[model samples]
Target: MNTKRLSNQGGESQHQMTARFTNKVVLVTGGGSGIGRSTALAFAREGATVVAAGRREEPLAETVKLIEARGGQGSAIVADVTRGDDVVRLVETVVARHGGLHIAFNNAGVLGTPQRIGDVDEATWSEVIAINLTGVWLSMKHEIAHMSRNGGGAIINMASIFGVHKSAPMYGAYAATKAAVSALTRTAAREYIAQGIRINAVSPGPIEAPMSLRPGETEAQRAERYRETVPLGRIGLAEEVAAAVLWLASPESSFIVGHDLVIDGGVTI
Candidate 1:
């Protein structure tokens, strides 16, 4: 098994992380940065051959480079989840190159312009729904088709705390899409579990990422907001969220299905 010490993403410094995904092939979307990058590295450190996919190649390449530096194996694939053709090709390429896909983290998403429901532009609304909602569906559509017939797999869709419990007024577009993702996760889980494809979701709030910060807000302001809102008194780390994704994708969560695991520092509690 491949072992490595992961750092820089909020964790115990340079501790050895054992392999939990030996001989598995994992695919991570939106893996160029933030939570996606962290999850991709985690998978690699745990002995999975990771394929990091995103619309951009540079950031994905950086993710691969980090994984390699940690003595893990990874590769970058450029694909936009918002496009059906891209998603299809993305899945095919991963399987073709890696032999088979045993796990997937559909984490690609966008935070559309935050505005009052009535004031949000059509373009912004459409983009949010397309990338955040439709994109996940497209990813599952292909992944399910592949995993069902290829001995099954685990799929973790990235949801949000906004969808599971609370929502601010201007976050309508993003919130709606996330809520839909939760519903979609349940529906897909029911449809695919019999075939051995275990589907689940991870709903996070105020993680260390650009999307969690509000417009015109500084990092300090965002930190203060989390203190007021999150019961844990701080924003979550990408590595923390990545740990949840890895659990959902691992055999440790074998009986878990259609569950939306919320990692919001007790904000929803």
Candidate 2:
């Protein structure tokens, strides 16, 4: 009986150990800047070969450079998440190059034109949903298909705190899309858990990123506003959010599925 118990414990120990993603293949969408860029770099540092996709060529190149500088392997693919053809090709190229995909971060999104619900035009709403919601679905569709072929993998969707709560006025379209992301994350997790695929989300509050601030907002004004609003008394940095993403991707979170890891500096508290 003691020998049998020891064998069982050893099996559990093997599952719990965390070399995690060594030699795994990871793909991150919107990986050119902000949280996406940071996530890609973090994955590379952890010994995963990365495929970073984005709309712009320059930022993708820069991310690839950073990964290579650290003696890690990564490639940049120029693709817009909103375009179905681009997304399909992006997944295909990654699988062809790496033989299999072990992790996918569907982090591409857009805030869209801020306006009141009644004032939001059809074009504006469509644009926001297309990129923020529909694009994520497309990425999942392809990634799941690929992962299914090779046993399974993990997927992390980038949501926002607004996904769980209401935003101020004029953020109708953006907030709605994020809320949809949360629902989709849970749905996918349930659909694929039995197949060795894990799906989860990361909802960040107001991280310091180029896209978070408005075009004409002064630095001081933005800083003062965030200081007053956030419970932590300061805004979060992109690297902090990336850390959460890395945790979800690693085996340390193997038992955690369908959960939204909220990183808001205690603002929601």
lDDT: which candidate is best?
A: 1
Worst 10 residues of 2 by lDDT: 1-10
- 10-32 in candidate 1: lDDT tens per residue? 34444245678989999999999
Clash list (residue pairs), candidate 1: none
Clashing pairs in 2: none
User: On residues 1-269, what C-alpha lDDT tens digit does candidate 2 reach at each position?
Assistant: 23234222123332232334678999999998888887887788777899999889999999899778766789999988888898899999998998889999999998877678999899989999999999999999999998887899999998898887546467888888888999999999999998899999999998777767887987566767888988888777776787788888887898999998889978788
Local distance difference test, per candidate? 0.89, 0.84
